[model samples]
Target: MTTQYGTWRKSRLSEANGACVEVARSLRGTIGLRDSKAADSGPILELTRREWTMFLRSIRAADKIG
Candidate 1:
């Protein structure tokens, strides 16, 4: 299925060196992720809201443990 993302937001931790990913949310509650540097031509990675939350939780847990 094809989904369209409206607005994309980049992480505050993103550097000025153009190495970062942008994330957007669709009306259907799906999350869209893509490269910030190549916003137009890059491939997008889509995930469900639950999956996105789990992914973020894992990253946060890893940060706490490490």
Candidate 2:
């Protein structure tokens, strides 16, 4: 699927500690993720809505466990 992404935005919680990520939504409703530090040259990881939700849940669960 050809994706046309909307505005990519970084999380406000990401301070200058260097662990930054940016996220955007494509016109077709997929999620786009990239490293904010290398945004212009880095690779993007796109995911469907379901994948995005699952990814979030897994990470949150892992965070709680760690």
Candidate 3:
């Protein structure tokens, strides 16, 4: 889906030491993720709502395990 990113937000995960990804909500049901270091490099990944949910679940599960 060709979506525009207007409300893109920088991740809280960003460190003063610098390694982070920025994210933006795109049109449709897609999530946009880009390298905070090189947004000009373009979005690194585009995920569907379901994919995003599953990914988040996996992260949560891993966090619990850790």
Candidate 4:
């Protein structure tokens, strides 16, 4: 099925260097992730909303613990 994703946004913390990721949400509520530099030409990683939430929670929890 074709998915229509929202506008991709880079992290505010992203540096000027070419090492950043962009994220967008699909109408199906899934998240789309791609390399900022490559953009549409790059492969996208798709994840469900729950998976994305869990991933963010893990990162934040790791930050707190470390």
Task: Please identify which of the two predictions, 1 or 4, would achieve the higher TM-score against the true structure.
Answer: 1
- What residue runs in model 4 are displaced by over 4 Å at the alpha carbon? none
- Assess each prediction's global lDDT (C-alpha) against the native: 0.91, 0.91, 0.78, 0.90
Q: Residue by residue across 1-66, what tens digits does model 4's lDDT show?
A: 767899999987787877898999999899998899899688889999899999899989999999
lDDT of 3 by residue, 18-46 (tens): 68778777767588888778877654688
Q: Whose TM-score is higher: candidate 2's or candidate 3's?
A: 2
Name the TM-score of candidate 4. 0.85
10 residues in a row with least lDDT, candidate 3? 1-10
TM-score per prediction, in order, is 0.88, 0.87, 0.79, 0.85
lDDT digits (tens) for residues 1-26 of candidate 1: 77888899998888899899899998
Clashes of 2: 0
Candidate scoring better on lDDT of 2 and 4? 2
Q: Model 3 reaches what TM-score against the true structure?
A: 0.79
Off by over 4 Å in 1: none
